[model samples]
Target chain A: MKASLTLGKVTNFLGLGFFITLKDLFTGKLEKEEFKNFLRKTIVPLVSILLFIGLWHLGAKSLYNIEAKFKIEKALQDQGQVAADALKTCMVSGESSCQPNTLPSPSQVWNSFQSLLRDHNIISADKAAFIEKTAAMNEKRVAAGKAAIVYTGRPSFVDQVFTSLQTVFAGFLLALLIAVPLGIFIGLSPNLKSAFNWFIQIFKPVSPVVWYLLVFMIVKTLLIGSTEDSSFTISFISVGLCSMWATLVNTAMGVSTVDKDYINVAKVLKLGTFQKIFKVVLPSSLPLIFTGLKITLSVAWMVLIAIELLAQSPGLGLFVWEEFQNGANDSNAKIIVAMFAIGIIGFLLDRLMLMIQNWVSFDKTDAI
Target chain B: MAYLELNNICKTYGQSDGETEVLSNINLKIEEGEFVAIVGFTGSGKTTLVNLINGLIKPTSGTVLFKGEPVDGTSHERGVIFQNYSLLPWLTVGQNVFMAVKEAFPKKNKKELHEIVANYVEMVSLTPAINKRPNELSGGMRQRVAVARALAMKPEMIIMDEPLGALDALTRGNLQDEILNIWGKDKRTALLITNDVDEGIYMADRIIPLRPGPNATLGPEFKIDLERPRDKTEMNDNPNFKKTRNEIIEYLMDIGNERKSEAKEEYILPDLVPKDFVNQFKFGR
Candidate 1:
């Protein structure tokens, strides 16, 4: 019995529980009924992903043909049959210059992804070489009463990704700091909750762009004499303001809804105010607080893109916006890549919060 | 003077039109080192009575005096064992006990507190499950942990508000005996609020009935008048035990029947019909 339990634990540890079920079936350790379930679980999602890609490829091809036909007609009207025929020939030859501007195919996106990585590498190398060559001059300048010359090289795609992560984390921390204590105080008092209810309701649904503009107005004035950029600060502050409402509301709800029985126990113990909140109320309300925090994180990530774009911050949002306006053949592909990056990062953040929640919560049921 | 006294206690919620007078004119007194049980049926405001005594909630009208002084807020001197076994789910049994012991005896050092916690945990035979969280333990085991935590405090008075009500009969009997054995050793001023007549007779020196509410108050008290280390098997045939038990059950049934009869109201359905059916009835019938 213990051996099987250990085997089950190891299977889950490696995240191969599903695969092991199939293995068990093949080895006659599982029933035919379970094998059918295994097939349904594994094969259905794979087939669905393939079907989605197939549909996307078909749509892209149709849109490409329409664009090509329109170009050919425009060339015919403006430059005659000979020119249109030449244009058609150029298109038929599959020249990148004459490529139709439309939704890119899966292969085009894959190629664009590779190109971005390669570009990042080249830029990284150039920055390193520039830093090394300028080291002595920068040192001499610093030794003197003058500022050292800094690298003005363009940031790579990976650099922008890192910048975005830093901004979001800053925003997430800021939101947590502001929301939790305020929420606890509000939750502890009914009058305070009533007073703040309008404030939360008014600001919660405001657009991220508007929040960015507000932060920009405040931060730009605050940093008027400072040489450092305020765009990052403004973007992150906006992201925090935009995303903090969910956590604030959730924390309040969690705190207010703590079990009355637990409060009685606190009373019976004659715990001081701090002990009552920390030992009894907080522990009881932690699950709901985590639920709120998860929502806040997702909101932070979602609001960050628009805020970054508005604030002109160096991040994924700006990268996607710049690519969109550049309108190169590969620019659309790059935006798609950014979209995937945003989704994966948001998913990872949610998983991270869940891990922390599970660690703190004594309840042993698997977190959703 | 009595160790604890409730003078003309009344507890009410809301004001004016929304007023709910849950308990009214409740008066009781218990001397120190005496075991007293307040017996009642479900929803007889027994918890409200307990809360009044423990200072969780205050009486709307009267005052509760403990040791010749007016009761204010909760204190370490009066420890409560709640009906729901209000053990903190995050803490293990040992930690739960440690928290109570720390609060009850603030001067004790860490080693002394640990010793107190360990002793109580052992007393309840929960040392095996000492490291297990409240959620991991069975209902009976969790109640035992609560019992350990309350005892670890070593309060002058231990108030139990139907602590074993949720357990199965056998488990309830086991916890009752376990609690009795501990109480026998100390003879603290203990107040038990329970619905069980057998439990009251078995545990308390005196049993008082909390008459059923909308305005519940204490009924007449029954003196157990039995020898210590009261055996359950022997109580079944003890003429005095049988007589007290019968009297309590009969009084409870009488009040229950009276409450039922009093609560039976005349039914008057609204003089209305569905719009569609009304038209049909008016046109055809």
Candidate 2:
């Protein structure tokens, strides 16, 4: 009985109740109905994923063959039958340059992912060695009042990912700082709401490219002779401007809809204006504010790539653009790898926001 | 001068031609340390009157004077317990009560404030769940916390608007007794707005009915002569309780029936029936 109790606790803690159900079914301790549910939840999805990959592989193969045939035919028409035959032989032998530039196979994308990992490992080792070798030198320079020499090597894939995360977080903070207070002020009075409505409507739908350009134009003049690189500032600011509308709108909506009874309570307490906002207004509207924040974070992340690419910042967006331009045999595979990484990271960020929203919001009607 | 007075108060919603007059010609005076309950049916502008007294809202054309001073806005002296338990969902019961006490007694140190919060929370028998959020508690428990919060402020006048209407019978009975017990200790000025006639008769020195509305106004007041420390079980057998209850209920019934009869309209049915339906009925098809 104690063991079963502990198992139940563990199931609740880790959301692993299904695994126990599966174990029970396999051990003949489950009912037929329970076993069927296990299959429906767990097994069907696995089969569907395999089916998806199989279709992708077939499609990739057909596209490769079509391109290869087209290349050979063009060679024959341009030169001679001998040249066509030589090109076919090169393609059949799987020479790197002769490979058709098209949608990469699943295995090729997997290999590219592994290669990127290996490159990150190598670059990390290089960085560690360089730091060690220059530790004494850097110290000497500091003592002599001279600048320290730093590593000038290109950032690895993992470094780029971290840079992107840092930029997105900065952007998300910026958006929250600008939107929430403005939204509250607008929500408090009808006059303010009407006055600001036109501004928000006009700017909310502006594209990321235009926002980036606007930031760039202003930041360039503002940072005049400063030696610091301003791409990070520009990229994050543009991201913030592009993504803040959802948070602003949702916060205003939430604040305006607070229950009248709660307002009355605040009034009867004789709370000051700021106290009313902090104690009564903010707490009541937090669920909607969090929903807005979730949307803002996702939008920040989506616009971050384009802004980074435009600013030429060292992040995933720049990395993807560079890979596309490099035109190497494995570049397509590497780009596909980055695409998957971006999708998975976006999903993870959303879940993180959801977890935070649940923690702060007193509404428990929905668990997740 | 009375402790609280409302003079020729009128309240309306909307503008000009589209106006809805919720309350009209409302005037009342309550002496210091008097307990009064205003009973009305739902949507009879009982809340508007309460809001006017507490200074959460202003009357369109009349005066609300508290302690002979014009009521301009809300004050800690008039603590209101709203119908819906407006406990901030994010804050625990201890924190909700603590915030009010802190606001009411800003000069009091943190220790004194905490003591007050703890005392009231214990008064409502919610000491075990002081750290619980409103969502975690039952409806009755939430209302109890709201009570604890309002009373902890040490308001001179406690204004309650149908606070126990949403609760079931057992919780309501328990809360009514608890409120009475607290009021018995010090006869603070209190006003309760409710739809329940019995609740008014049991709790107050005087019971006043708010007539039903298009422009609802105050009806005649019923004076309750029940003795102090009123017993709930004994209340069922008391002659005065039955008489007052019957009188209030009958007056309300008369108001309802009068309104219905006035609204009763005659409708003449169209003098034609469908030819096919008539033929089918005659042939019994």
Candidate 3:
């Protein structure tokens, strides 16, 4: 009886093991297929980037003399050390004394990030207490820093990224608000179209920097007056004006490109204004409109970065500028890393916009 | 009173150097439930006449009365099937038909609307491909969808502008039969624009020839006077069908010969003009 019971237990264990292995195999197959698709989409781009990095590293190592190469390697090593020391000190003593002049390496930034995550309460505690003490102080700060980047001198890469993203989105949204209806008006009526044609022709070729400057000046004169900190106002105005042009041009073109047959169909049906736009015009023009939007979004991103760099606003552009200004010492390697991070973030932002365009795009077969 | 009337219609295009005329003195009265076929050669203003009736374009001098009212623009009362198969590419066959049905019967419940569309689609034998888009469909299928869409509306008048002109011989025969079968049941007032004499004889109560241009006009109307439900093979044997087909073909052949002579005269003009100028001027000198 004892032997039989033991044998039965052993068989059950084996069965369970087999079942677990089967489940794992199924899951592994699914994951592998998904990963393969992902790789198919990204492999060419990844290989190209790796090749570029390899070439860059090779050039730096081989083209430069031994001493020059050593200097760069030592600087990079020093940056790593600084990051480790800063992280160690922050963890041990609950404070950071790292200077802004010295750029932090990847490891240093990671360490700082880990420390910030741990001590989030410490940063917010004083503010919470201050808010309880004086509500007016919170309002003043909120108003002042609402548009500005609310970062300490030692801001994380995420803070910079989030700030830039917020600015770009805000400007893009504002551009859409201004452009779409105007575009429709222009597209529908000959009089409106003729009136706007000259304006479009004149303004379309104008540079974004020119638009930025003009808008900045106008906003300053009209609303804010001469203020020491006009960074936020200037950044918003410049980005908004620059991005708005693309959306306006695209929206008008999209609406105009709608099939004439659809218009006749609308007339035959006697669809109401709203119904006509929603049912006929909008669907027909969707492909063009989405393409326009893609172009507009990319332009908005580029404009936001330009404005941030030029205006000294808080964003990845500003972060890059600050790192570059800190000199060709140990921080140069950190600046290069920041450049890579910026590129990756921009690529991701473009892809996100592409996904959105895909989501909203009318199925090609559905077009009348 | 005529269900639709065209009184002394005329259309002239330009004023000066490049003056062109499309149609002149077109007069016709279509009774309710009458099927009329207007046959013409290419660029013979067959389309122009239909467009005037559909109110896509207006005559330079005349009026079109629909049910005792002036026809202004496109309406649900008159459904037009264009030669190009204007089935909204984005919509499926069912949806294309449903769109017309929905517009015509806005108050209809979903079930009623679906039934009406399905009935029309099935009438054209497109039930299997009802969910397919125009692009997904064959040319014949797409044209059938267009036909189904028109018929589903249950319009007072159906205007077909060479709707099956693009189809192959087999598909054309099939669609022609399908259209005739559908028309036989309801007897809706239909004006078919086609170049095919056999098609006119098979489908229409009366066949009218549109003469070739520099201002095309309607030739003498020929009444089919044959029995209902025309069979393609049997109609060939029918004496009336043969007589009418031959008469129409002979008339077209005469016009074709006249056009060729005119083209020959045009080619000969340049050479003769120089010789005539030299003789006249030299004699005067």
Candidate 4:
């Protein structure tokens, strides 16, 4: 009886009871208390999110209208008759005023998302028609052993997302290729670590913008005589350089601090140098290396926007910059839409890395 | 010729200020198929001696010979069961054993390798947990995996460094019997390092006491002439067991007393005088 009681307590402590309650609720056998608890758990977060959106809807209107109007009036009130006429037009027409440009409410952002999707559909149709018209000519060119003409239309919102993903992954791959071996080398030899330490320290904290400029200079020179696009290469290289430090530092630390016992085991087993590293050192240090990779990936993503914008690479960053420059009434709303898209994608990327980390790591609890 | 030999082995650790000698003038020889146990206190450098035998570490000055050849780097011929379970955490129990088997017998087919791993894992009675990783295992279970991994490698000699030190008494006894059972067949040359005197006598053909360190060395060896398949219950009443136990205890006690006095001698306070000593003259040194 005591054992059963203890088991019951343990199960309850681990919240196994909550799952049982959920099962019963689904089966229409839940008791009053359990039903209430289930509803609280499920419905509360939803309700809170709705409440938050509602608050945002109200707050954005009041903040944008009054603040933007005040700024415009204060700036233009001292000018002249022309300024007075412009101010009158701005105050009379909501879209003509600066308020809509400053802060777009939830409804406006939602409308902008819908319009962007519509624009994407139209552009996609146009691209399809262009491809169909060019198919015969392109086929003839292919038969003649010449390259076909490529589509040169402006990328849509969705296309920009794909471009951003491509850039970040390319950059992350390059970082991994460079950092892991360099880290292992530095970690294995104290002399090498000391030799590289000054370089790492000097360059690790250099801003992504500076890295972009440096990469842009080199890539521009390399591509000056070539007709191919250099923006993608420049942006990716900059992203890779900017994010390489995290992986390098973490990998080195991981390799250097591997448990001495594991190394001793490798010795006793008489494992070859290659076998020892691949079978022991790498596996043991994987958790730290993975942590570094996750950080590197996120950093690569965070700076990819700035890199893309500066380099004029086709990505979400460029989309945001273009919209900001457009400064139309709906441009502000579209930019807001892009911001949320970036945030959501960033969150999903992190989750993807976490999933992979958990899958590979033996110590699953320590993955995060 | 002895299967393994350690001649005048000495090890010193260099500190920032000075060198602290851990083991000095250590000499031992184990004949073929002999089970030897070295018993010592926690700080008596038992692990250092084990490392020396396993070729994991080099003695500051001396020679370690295996079958008349001087020990250099580690070789697959000498298998070690570490005090801490050194089974790779990422590898499953079967995979852990398989890794060693693969290394030792690289020419073996995949099926043959799997059989070797399965056989060892079964020997340790961890067949059910073949797929489970190290972190999922209990402490005792993990050590059993380590044991299986080391044994599966089929080394000519085995070195166990406090293999059961962290286990509960019942688990320790269980593993001790398991080791002895494995040792009975073919009786490969083996060395067991332990702090437990009873355990040393119970498992080994001969029990050698290692004196506490700061230049610690082997004291004496006691031979256990008990019959095969010794039962713990019967050993309690056996005269030979009693005699061996008492002899080891007495020798260890003598070393403890000697070390205690040496420590006491080193604890002498420094003599110093300050201008304010007159104020506390009653307590002045």
Candidate order (lDDT) = 2, 1, 4, 3
Give candidate 3's error at residue A237 in angstroms: 3.8
The candidate with the higher TM-score, 2 or 4, is 2
True contacts kept of each: 0.91, 0.94, 0.23, 0.86
Q: Write the per-residue lDDT of candidate 3 for residues B1-285, one digit (tens) a residue.
A: 899999989987788778788898888888999999999999898878887888878889988999999989888889888878776766778987887788889999999999999998998999999888788889999899889888888888899999999999999999998888888888889999999988898899999999987689888999998888777888889888889899999998998898888775443444343357777898999
Interface RMSD of 3: 2.1
Q: Provide the lDDT at A265 for model 3.
A: 63
Candidate 4 residues lying further than 4 Å off, grouped into runs, are A1-55, A68-100, B265-285
Error of 1 at A24 (Å): 6.9
Ranking by TM-score: 2, 1, 4, 3
Candidate 2 — which residues are off by over 4 angstroms? A1-41, A189-191, A366-368, B268-285
Model 4 chain B lDDT-worst window of ten: B259-268
Task: Residues A158-200, candidate 4: write the lDDT tens digits.
Answer: 8899999999999999999999989988887899999999999
* Cα-based TM-score, every candidate: 0.92, 0.92, 0.76, 0.87
**Winner by lDDT between candidate 3 and candidate 2:** 2
- lDDT per model vs. reference: 0.89, 0.90, 0.76, 0.88
Q: How close is candidate 3 to the true structure, as a TM-score?
A: 0.76
Residue A335 shift from truth in candidate 4, angstroms: 1.7
The collision pairs in model 1 are none
Per-residue lDDT over A1-368 for candidate 1, one digit per residue giving the tens place of the 0 to 100 score: 79877777555544446766766777888677887878786677679989998998999999999999999999999999999999999989988888889999888888888999999999999999999999999999999979988888899999999999999999999999999888898899999999999999998899988888888888889899999988889989988888888889988988998999888888888889999999998888888778888889999999888988888899999999999999987899999989888998898888778778777887647355
C-alpha displacement of B30 in model 4, angstroms?
1.5
